[model samples]
Target: NSHRVTYIHNLFQNGAATIAGVSEMFKERKRRGEIPADEEITFIMVTGDGGADIGMGPIVGTANRNDNVILLEYDNEGYMNTGNQLSYATPLGHATSTSHVGPAQVGKQFQHKDTIQIMAGTHIPYLFTGTESQPQDLIKKAAKAQWYAKNYGTVYGKILAACPLNWKNETRDGRNVVDAAVNCNFFPLYEIEQGITTLTYDPEAKGKKVELEDWLKMMGKTKHLLKPENKEIVEAARKEVERRFKRLKAMSEHPDL
Candidate 1:
């Protein structure tokens, strides 16, 4: 029935509704013997961070990750496709359509949701973060996810995406932005296997890590942080980046934890 696949399209109004609809459709097919009783269905949940924010909290607590399911998150740090509006994934002190920085407010006051940590807390069989900047690394992680889901159990992969348009950057500059993010400690490359955490990419070979300012200036979205009056916001962003890096390093050192 590959040629006759059904389609369902909506504004993603409600994640719970989608869950129910998919389950019902699967059941109907099974009841009609379309799928053998012994066979299992592989459910892949591909969602932007927006949909995740709406239903993540409850689903993480309720869903069984140790099954034939994979959650692939294409994280661009905001609702990029939706006119640069702010989403739960938007970083702190960054300007978004919903969280415009001006005299009235200081951009998004809160940092990006630490969904990576939250997923790790689930203690699923596999969890990893991949950046488009590191193509081979991302490919490896994606292959691992597919292998584990088909062989062992479930896996979650959060892949960082770049939005040149939303970020007000040249198309070719997008890769450089991602590179700066990693070098500046804004987005770390790592994976958690079994109960152990490991760092996949490190920029320490260059002696000092790239400055956060370099990353901010790479995209227009974060250019506000470079203003003289916005120095404090820049400092705040640094503090957060350092804090998260420290936590991740600690986790890597203490894998059992």
Candidate 2:
């Protein structure tokens, strides 16, 4: 059997796809033998953090959107499509069009939302993180999303991308910034399958685990935090990265999770 692709606009302007609606469509497809009983159908939704996070309702809807639909997040940290405004995914201490840094104001005051944990909390079958830094790893996750290798539920993946124009970095160095983000543990690579968590990329290799400053200095968006007087904010960002990675490490060790 072969699969088909379709696009639905007005997802927000008209109405977000609900559980009942998606369930019925897949049911009908299978009933018509359009989807083979032995072949798992792959339903994919690629969106941005700012738009997808407007309400948890969509996230909840996605969790129950049959045992298919994989949501891929092209996480650009800020709303790249909207003049680099701050989104929930933008890290703290990073300056954006919406979250500015000045003598009195200090970039974004909040840490990026724990999106992965939120998706994980839904008890979805699979959750993955990939970055432009590692093209091979990203490709593997994309393929895995279609296969449902171990479980039969949602397979979500987040791709950490560096915006050269927004980040005030050279276009040629965009990939390097992605690599730094991974090595700094700011956006580590991993996956959760059937409640079993695994760390796909280990940053423990020699010179692999670098200080968060190394990552921060790569992009001008976060250059404000590197200021001598802004040491406290810099430390806070570093601590957050460390804390997040620690939790991920624990999750990776517990395969029975």
Candidate 3:
């Protein structure tokens, strides 16, 4: 049977909650034995940002026990179709209707949610993460995920795509955004196989550490976070980078033990 459920988080948009509710419904059906134990189920999560579909991560985490979950994150940080409201995926200082900048000038006060980390922590049997910019990598990850699902029972994959309008960039510049992501190490092209994390394309394996400026320059919204006058903000951003590196180090040390 096919069904769709909608979840509304503070009425921000219908995308996130919709995906979450549908997954939940299927799980409920399976638990009650309403559906045959052998029946196969697949949950498709579609959202613009990491924050909108936070529910999907855990659902995939739990549902992977008996089903397949595919997550797609459109790089648009805000509610693009809904008057461009700021979502949790919105970058640190992007000016949105909800986060308007005044004379005092402060944009979204919070950093965007890292949905990848949330899913990675789940330690699912099969997890694949890639960006749409790398079509080859994306296809490879998707194919492997399907293989795992068909043969091993469950799989989970996440893809990141560019959102030009939300990022105040031209649609024609989508490729540029992807290139920036690679150049800045903001979005590396990689895949997780059978719970093992491996870097697929490490152009910087021997290169210098990616600086915060690389990401900030491409993301207009995050530019304010580096205002020279705000020493505290600058230091905070640096600290965040250091913390991220540490996490990556930990992941590298143990991919799927």
Off by over 4 Å in 2: 1-5, 11-23, 32-41, 149-151
Winner by lDDT: 2
Model 1 off-target regions past 4 Å? 1-42, 61-65, 205-208
Report lDDT (CA) for all predictions: 0.77, 0.78, 0.60
Error of 3 at 74 (Å): 2.7
Clashing pairs in 1: none
Query: In candidate 1, what are the lDDT values of residues 57-92, reduced to their tens digit?
Result: 534743353554567777887876667788878888
Between 1 and 2, whose lDDT is larger? Answer: 2
* TM-score, every prediction: 0.84, 0.87, 0.70
Candidate 2 local lDDT, residue 226: 83
Give the TM-score (vs. native) of candidate 1. Answer: 0.84
Can you write out model 2's per-residue Cα lDDT over 1-257, one digit (the tens) per residue? 13346555445311234433564587688789987767544556666776656645766676765345677777888778779989889898899998888876888988898787888888888789998879899888888877772257667778888789899999999999999889889898998877788889978854588889998988888887888999998888889989988888888887665
Ranking by lDDT: 2, 1, 3
Worst 10 residues of 1 by lDDT: 7-16
Using TM-score as the measure, name the better of candidate 1 and candidate 3.
Answer: 1
Per-residue lDDT of 125 in model 1? 79
